[model samples]
Target: MGYVKLEIRCPKNVAIVTSADPDPVWTLDDLLSELNSLELQHGARISVSSPPKKSKMKEMANGSNKPFVMRITDDDVYESESEDESTDQRLITGTRFAFPDDYFSESDEFDDEMHEKSTPSRLMQKKSIEEGALFELESDHQLMVKEQLRSKLSSLELSQKIESENSSFAMRRLEKQAEARQELDRRLDKQYQRKIAEILDNHLSILQRNHEQRSQIEERRIRDDATLEEAKRKEKALIDEKLRQEKSKAEAEVRLNAIKQAEAQKAAQEAEIRAAKEAAEKQAARITETAVFDASKKDLTEPKGVENTRTSGNIKQGDFVTKQLGIRVIASKAALEAESNRLAIYDEVAGRINVIDQKVIDKHGRQMYKYIKQIGGTVENVRAKAHVLVQLIKDPMLPLSISLLVFANKVVSLCENPSGSFDKSAFACGWVIVLIASQVPDVMDLVLAEFHRSCIYTVPKHLQASDAASQTKDYWKMLGYREEDGKIESTNEFLNRVESCMKLYAALIQTEIVGVKNPYGLNYGWAWLAMFLNALPANRTTAVALEAFLKMAGFSLLRKYKSQFMKVLNVISRRFLPSLKQRGEAVHDIVMKLEQYLDDKIYLREPEGRQLQASSLSKFFE
Candidate 1:
């Protein structure tokens, strides 16, 4: 077939750079201009054309190529070309070197003395004239033809000898192959027998072990039952003894009460006489002491002997004061101190106090009128004050609901007021308020209304100082992401957050493992880890790690946390399924490893052992 010419029009200015540059500066227009200049300076004689365009460009681009054409150059650019004299004979004529047309002319005479060929084909007839001119005698030409035939026969015999040798070698190879196959069959049969024997032994051992365990469990169960019965009997006996004690105590209490009644009357008379005598003595002492203390206080003399007395007097006063208060005062003081110690405990449970600036709200009223109108309520109508706010939340007004606006001024004021580390009342009140506010679908409409004219508070440097985004991206880097400047550069902060969330999810799953039992718990841990790994984006390193983890924990183990794993899988599979055939094998390989591990542990005593038998036969076919 005549090779079809390929062509492509070069842009007037385009120029392909010979070498790549880090800071190469070139524009589309510049490239077009360069190409046009190059073409004008050096025509077809200098510039080469690109390869041809075909209907299968898409397929070819993937990694396919057509036959090379001489007209096209090495560079991936195009130019048109014309057909040449040399055509592929197999494509055009189905044969090589056809007879020339001039042989059919009658101008050539057939001579008796001319060397003759016996062939009657069209090609022979055309070659007759040339042959007659070369060999004039028929006998001489015949002898030359006979010699050529002998030479060909000799070559044919040599070829037959090589063929015979090849046939014998092939037969020998076939026989050897048959023998090798027989040997393999014999070995396989022996292995199969061994496997069967091992399986039987494992079964027997497992049965024996199970029988022993069952008996031990039965004995323990019986012992537990007997102990439980004994405890119950003892409990009943204790109850009877308590009942008899209560009866005896009741009789004794009645006798003691009757005896106490007579003593009460005698005591009351004695207490009245004592109180009167004490009052007279206290009044006389108070008057005398008040006069003496007043007269002594007037004196400022620091007497040397009185210094020791003063010290002793101070010590005596401390002792007396402590004695008077004793345990009750200490207990009360301790209770108060404990309350202070626990102050921080409550703060954590509470939220910060968000005080609203009514003045700001009033000033921004007109600016926020649109929002208020949207909510079908006026800000002025909403209730204020802590307790009133809580109550209003319990029963919000129709159409208006509840809108709590924390103005920039209010936020600043609250930050300044360090009285409450966190305000419990404010947090509780806020939730209650929001509950009421939810009655209005357009709660934001009314809420933003209060802050319409308020300035957007610049986030405090202290609050915004956390490297949350960077840290999150770094965590993903560990999981595997394209790193930039020694850190993962995710397209958005949101993806980093997702990566961090996956890490948390993995941790939570492992935490949940602490509460699990064998089979069930192990499965749960494995499943959660699988889910976390699965949720990770399709990165080669991450995928490999996931496969390894899964293999250590089987897919069947996911049944341990079926509901949770399935929910995660449902979301992940949508993204993964398109490439599942490639990934599934990886997952399966990991699962097999885990399954084998579990089996080994569960049936250690079995003859076959816990390990899965390697599928050698399947591997051979593969």
Candidate 2:
């Protein structure tokens, strides 16, 4: 029923640019240049956005705080390899980064070597072979030494040699045995050292001397305790004194708080009394003003069938008559005349719109334009204008509800129409209407008062009652309409009209709505308006507006509505998106569908029928 907000966590692949300038113009080349410049510095793996915008750009341009939309295209747009080089390319935001097979060829050997060496299994195999070779050499050397020692044992020699050999052999054996014994002794010594360390670490006797010293210190401390007891008592007294001071401080704070609260209460009471007196006085004044206005109105109404009358003094007869009825109001006539012309054109155009009046349209258009200017709209104005001439139509006094509707509708129509003038007056008028209209929801409760004071008709009682009934109804049957969930059904024809009106509304509101305006006008102006119309059902005219918006959006309202379609798809996606593979497949499917659709509409062979078919297809997705 109000505005819709979407929180999109743009992926790394998409670049966004948001603009606060309201209107901006830049070509595709411009956008590409900016992105290319950015890529040269920030890398291609970024999404640069202009400020958060309500819509997309008609043309690309550098925007102020505006976010520009970008996406990596490496995933798409390629077919086969080239003869000159292997055509492998990565596109970031439409700028191609080519990666040809030839480009990688020079590094192939290096890459292979690096790859092989990096493999854990391969590295381990090489290490094992080296260790095996070293072990084999050592084993061979040990075998040779054993053979030599055997030879030495078998050698025949003189008595001295044999004796010497036996003695040397025995000595060698003795040395070996001694070395073995020495090793055993060393191990035993290490064990003994470990045992000693364990005893030292675990035994309480290790600390006996230190403990005795500590005990002596404790005894001395006990002896000294008596002397310090007096000081301790004094310290306790000081602590008590500090505690007393803190207690007094806390009490004082509590008293201060109480006094402050009392003062605040007294001030509040006095303010309330003053406010009450002022309110009473204001009420009295309002009552007096109402009485005077009523008396004057009554005097005028006493006359039979009075269509319009000029007022004398402070009394004006007609509801449409402003203070100027008595005395000419001072304002710019030229600006007023321009508005008059615009309104005239609006009336003519809306005259044909069966159930709606041009005045309400105008009022709404003006209001929307005002809001646009306030938020920020382009200095340049749109070229289109809504103009219609009502032939064989009677000039009738429109009720306030109908009149307001006409006024609002006309305002919307003018903004939608490109062939219109722009001026400070147009902007100002729109601003005032929107400012006032914003207060309407709040004022709905005070409709009776507004009616009495302003002498405008209230919302039709039957319409209000019917609205209430619809709110409570589980289902209200209307043939030829489809029901989707809790929404009311309406005929396709009716929906189409609503969509059309929505387009008109969007065109008017886009400039004013935050984030939706495109200086070059590429963004869908009517998105918000379409959303608004889809949700609204207060009036048939509103339904017509919604249908208009749908048509403009190139969407069919009869079969699967765009919003509903998106909702259903989104629900399905949520179920499958938890799995990466499934999500990728889904994305692939969507991409394929879009590609096929584009090809069919743009590249099909049909000649004469192409335009019509293409147009129809465009409308389907509009």
Candidate 3:
């Protein structure tokens, strides 16, 4: 709800004034942009009455790169008016004729008696066309007015055609000149590179040949005999190493399997009598207890009543009970407060880790991710790169596990503003987290909590409608509103961020690096999908998040769950899409894409770039 009146000075200083909504003055930029398409010989110059916004105005300015705020003076306005009047008068020489039926003559005999001279009486009779009047001219120009107009129009069209062709010819000549210059530069550079490459190759080959010849001359027979034995020895050592790693991995899996079995049995025992939700809660608690290593560090116990420090003779039972209950109430409140503090600590840690200076990330983060991404593809290369990355960012004071998770935290933080190489290296970051979490399960919990804080749907939780004053702007911030300079982002931009976070989370679940299974794998993904669809209302934002998640994780889920995945898709089509339809154009396109993704069976084809190039892991996802 605002207004913007714009005064534009086109070429020849023709001043045009217009108004626009100022509530969102952003439209002013767009309105100015539209002026570029107008046929102004010199581009339109905008003149604003208000003080200039140096930042935005400079950005919106044309080639001169500053505000071209033309001052509209009386002289310029008067000249523009005179220019328009002259053009009008030149065109007024034409005979203004009306159809015979529409025209009504005031006095038809006046024209017969009238000589070839104009009189006020005759002029008064000829009113405008709207009054059903016609002009009876005394000048000879009326006889050939049609011919004159037709010739003028033809001449104008021919001149315009010639000008257009001349402009195009000039443009083509300039383009050819530029292309020729670029081609010459490219050929010169190519020749220089080729010569340098040839010189280096020849020098390296000569040195290598001479060294081989020397070695062969000194130990020809011995070297040839030992080569096979050396190969066998190295192969044996590699096999033993791989076996040891496999054995340790198997042991960890067995331990996890036993814990899962105990929970499964517990769930089965309570299935008939206990509420399914209660069982689920119990199961989740048990899994968290088993999986979260940091749980031991965060031992926050409620305070309990101590034995009577100084026992008096005899205490009333009711009084003692009342005192204990009050103590418990205070303790419970303290515990809840402590829990909120703990969550804040998690947020603080995540923020701190992700906010590592840009220079540090560029120096170490990308390299760390690169080594982790194609880890086993080339063992020697990965080893060397990972070592370099560790040296670059290593904290000798921290424990190995702590250092690894902290490193992973740094990598995840890059997703917050993926303006650099961080996005290209995201796959590696996902793998880094999964691999770290495989040994230190607290790592996964920390990452999930951070993502949940950023994007609520990763937790598959929706904000419930509430009238409480506490659930104001603070509530939206808690649900991860993106804020910059104390201003919240627009709806579309916020959703874009939500979608990015969802994609990262999806990548986390879809990962299967080396033999370390994704700790929170497709089962968790299945759970998220069910909970999201069941609880979250379908809207444009909902569709955006869901579409992003599916794009990253869908093919894998389809491969693993088959018909079950299809059924969930069916639910989305039947239940989710109709609600999304009412949300506007934003949702409409995504919903159509979602439908096409489902009906076209696009998930049957695995998404490209998802497949990592580990020796055996390459085809595992397929």
Q: Name the top TM-score candidate.
A: 3
For every model in order, what is the number of clashing pairs? 14, 92, 3
What is the C-alpha lDDT profile of model 1 across 525-575, one tens digit per residue? Answer: 443343232222232223333433333333433546556545444433444
Candidate 1, residue 31: how far the Cα is off, in Å: 92
Model 2: per-residue Cα lDDT at residue 263: 58
Clashing pairs in 3: 2-22, 2-23, 3-22
TM-scores of all models? 0.18, 0.16, 0.40
The alpha-carbon lDDT assigned to residue 146 of candidate 1 equals 40
Worst 10 residues of 3 by lDDT: 288-297
- Please tell me which model should have the higher TM-score, number 2 or number 3: 3
- lDDT for each candidate structure: 0.33, 0.34, 0.52
Q: Candidate 3 lDDT, tens digit per residue, 1-622? A: 1222222223444343222111112122233243333315345443322222344335646544432233458996687556544543222231122234312344535433332232223222322331121111211123233334454566778889999999999999999999999999999999999999999999999999999998887697778668978998799768766864685475456546644655564355335324422322222211110111100111111112100111121221111111211111111111222223334435444444454555654545555555554433333433344455455433333323334445555555555665443333444456656655665554565567567556766765444222233334444555566667876555656676777778778877887766777778888787667655644456556677898888878899988988888788877777677666644454577889888888887878776547545434545656
Report the error of model 1 at residue 68, Å: 66
lDDT of predicted model 3: 0.52
Judging by TM-score, tell me the better candidate of 1 and 2.
1
Q: Which candidate do you rate higher for lDDT, 1 or 3?
A: 3
Worst 10 residues of 1 by lDDT: 456-465
